[model samples]
Target: MSDRDEQAYAGTAEGKGPVRIDEELARHLENKREELFEEFEIRDEFPPEVLREAEERAADPEGDIRTELEDRRDLRELTTWTTDPADAQDFDDAVSIERTDTGYRLWVHIADVTHYVAPETAMWEEAMERGNTVYLPAYTVHMLPPILAETVCSLVPNEDRLAHTVEMHIDGETLSHESIDIYKSVVHSDARQTYNDCEDRLEDPDAPLHEANSLAYELAEKLHEQRKDDGSLVLNPKRDRAHTIIEECMLKANKAVTHTLQWDRGLEAMFRVHPQPTPQEWDEALQEIQELDGVSIPGDAWDDPRKAVNATLEEAPGRQLDKIQWAVMKVMPRAKYMADPFGGHHALNFEIYGHFTSPIRRLSDLVNHWIVYTDGVPDGIGDLCDHASDKQKDGETCERIYKDFLQEVGLDPHAVNNRGIEVVDDPADAEYTA
Candidate 1:
């Protein structure tokens, strides 16, 4: 049975999984499951065999079912996948490396999203409304249908998929490149290597996969080190959970997107930029830390602003930096959707940083890829940006309302009263504006 069929069965009564008390309870317990059924309204229940198969599929690390669903024949044809399975489908971008007299020419082929999602179509409308996919702990609700997001728009490897290729040449160390070309082309990904795996290989050249593909690994490290030496702060904190291969893969993809836009295409990219704390805010936070008399700055106060703040937090051992960072975020202009061709990313200290990869999870990246591919910005790029921002606000409002409702249901009086207030006891805010 297909993976979808198996998933359907696992959620049914006959599956080895514990039977639900009733439909209502089941729906209540499994919010996502209920939402899927209610939204799509799929009535047919899966067979017992299908449920077992789904269980097995879920345990599989590669997410084969999702890939299969994405690479269905009809979808493949629609998205222009004309390559063998092993060499095709699933990669959303490809990078070509070639040795040049001076350095190397890098060709980054991103999936052509505009080819599949035309404006005013249901898919496009839904995607725009969503702003982007919302990832929960259990499952993902895609902005577009599986066919469009997974198969057609995905720049899967080995497949002759349509792409907006960005070709450029890099000098010795710096990421200095010009936009060589931005046009539709058929291309394939040579390989799919995650960041952690790549890092491991870099640390140990004798690693299993390192022997086969050492050049890419070496280049990535060189690039990483170069960026760090040039004032790019490596402040990526370890996530709470152990790093999985899948998470590493996603990070590598994200990093590749940023590098391609900065190094391959001389395009100014919108980054998740964070500015240093202003003196006033910093002083206030510092005073608070000083009040904790025995406490000191956590670590070394390095030259880098990011590291300096992190070090201070480590020394002081308080939530001052967190509070200051949050306030500083408020003071700074929020990074929004934009098309910048000059290439300026102050946060990373790079000239460019754009989100071009992960079309499957982010609508902005999808639209950004389209803009890069077409060589000119999309007709309604500005409107899309505004709409996406508004939609994000709406989602946040909805989550807040839901949380408030939950608090009410759970009889949390304090939460109910402080539902919207950020600061309740600030005497100076007697005449504060909302």
Candidate 2:
């Protein structure tokens, strides 16, 4: 017999294994091979630009874009004029302050992403491929090339960068603001600060930070508390399972964007909104809550929708709120791309809320900023949204396929067990045995 045939039969002849490979085993092996090939592709496909940028950053971390902007003395350095960028490399959004006849004027400057990531540039294509930056447990997969995302397109300080600015007139007492205008403009970030540091400085006068930073911190606090009092939801949703520390930066950035959109732009943009609970779903959620006794609903549930949701969630600690929210989300129509002149945000009970930040990370926000700022729309804003949605779906599928591949390779045991065929319903008893 041929050597290959001989080897194939050796195990069977020794009574150590099956005589032939089974279909299931063959399929599993094929999946494992495919997974290894994909891993190879990922490694090989690592963008050369990103690698170069990483090397440059490694060689001179301080020379990186974030650092340069933070050190600049232009508008970015003036706390009274503009707040620091959220992250050092963040070039997308900036907060501006002005003394108005009424009290104060605040403007949020957002990067005009459509200006650079036109229809199908290499950076735009890469961003589309990623759907969004994926913050895995150990690493991050950015949606755009680092050169653009971390530098040029970023809303860095000191440099006169282009932006879609949203100006607002604030009533200092209630921390409420009326949108004044949304238009393209130029900005220079004076500083770069993280939420923790900013919050600390705001709470403690002795904390070392720019003097103007204290004012920004105070304003942010007033706005935060005002939103809570104004019926804004404040459910601290559970994070993804494979948590990453970098996500905190992203969350803070998201909050910054939300604040800018709601307080400055005044235009209603698509939001990740959650409707009030329906009777049926609320009942089920309540049942689940009752099952776990000793949990109390928050006292202020009736006063705020967010508080109410928090109260329901307080009944069960940990992921109970997240799971319930997910269930609630499933019952509602998903928030999608749309144009609304009135600032109608049902969940927040606001007339205006949009996403104008994170152009470096999200395609939708990038596109939205362009539409609101520039006089004319980009080549294909509608098509871009459609394509972005498709790409997002495709990425999700690829993730699922990769997880299955890992299972086949014995790298993810939980995945394998989870995929086992589930019996939906039992057939009529016909000599059935447990």
Candidate number with greatest TM-score? 2
- TM-score of each candidate structure, all chains considered together: 0.55, 0.58
lDDT of 2 by residue, 361-416 (tens): 66667766654544345564456555555554544454556556545444432322
lDDT (Cα atoms) of all candidates against the true structure: 0.44, 0.47
lDDT of 2: 0.47
Cα error, residue 79 of model 2, in Å, equals: 2.2
* Model 2 worst lDDT run, 10 consecutive residues: 1-10
> Model 1 shows how many backbone clashes?
17
